[model samples]
Target: MINEVTRALVAHLHSRTPDLGSWVVVHSLSAADAAPAKDKLALCLLAVDEHDHLRNSPPVEVAGRLQRAPMQLRLSYLVTYFGPHDEAMARLTRVIAVFHTTPVLGQDELPLTLGEQVERVTVRLRNTTADERNQVWSVLGRPGRLALFYTVDVAPVRLLPGLDGDGRVLAHRIDLAGTP
Candidate 1:
């Protein structure tokens, strides 16, 4: 599911920023890896963490049946532009602008596979402290470069049946003995 989300996001970025051309690469962050060639960009999924606020949500009710709520996740990514510093900055700025304009990826904008699985996704720029940012890069064994951190919230990724049988209210009864 995470992979699917990443791919869908990459596709969305491609469509939204056609001026950048075909230069989006999805892979793990590696310091040893050579920089992306000119005219290329990379999207490295740095981490996937649960959204703390929704971690303890109650089971969802659907069609008279209770089902376990899906896991709400916040996916982090390092958007890197590899090229001349000036051009790279330009591309990065455009990337920021695009996300700002379309903060939410609606069901229609999602890839077919993702659209079926998720109702919508919210993208936001994450403000990480220098220490946190350094830690992330350290974990990847890479030195941080000119990159932006963005988080995508994917809610309710899976659903589990809460009970076996359907719950129904068959009838209503009223007591009028006193009135009689």
Candidate 2:
């Protein structure tokens, strides 16, 4: 699902600016750094966390059996520029503009890779302190140049079926306050 979101963003970027070419990609800095391209921007997965919005999602009925709700996740990515500073910055500006215009990707925009439960994905810029930024760069083993931080919302991870039993209120036991 994470890859699906990134892929959707890549396609969106390509569609918005054909002049930018197909330089928008999803790859690790450590891997790409070895064989870097002349003009490219890598959208690297930075982190992932559970989305609290659907903490208590309703059970889904599939094949007459109620299945546990899919786990919702939020993903973070860093758009790092590689190549000449001037041209890269110009392209990054366009990238910002594109995202600014369309920050959310819905079922109409997203590929089929996303689960049926996931209706849409939200993208937004994430603000971080200098120390936090330094920490992230240090972990990635790259000297900070220029990067765009973004967080994509709500990727559903489907869990296995076969819940213990038919989900129902079998019985209601009522106890009086004075009764043991």
lDDT leader: 1
Task: Give the alpha carbon lDDT tens digit for every residue of 19-102 in model 2.
Answer: 767878777776336635768888888888888787788887766666666778888888877888997788789888988999
Candidate 1 stretches greater than 4 Å from native: 32-35, 160-180
How much lDDT does candidate 2 score? 0.78
Per residue, candidate 1 scores C-alpha lDDT tens digits across 1-180 of 789888887888889888667778786767777655667778888888998899878767677665656779999888887777897898888889888999899889988888888878898988889998888789878777678899989866775445443344468999777763
Worst 10 residues of 2 by lDDT: 160-169
lDDT of each: 0.80, 0.78
Colliding residue pairs in candidate 1? none
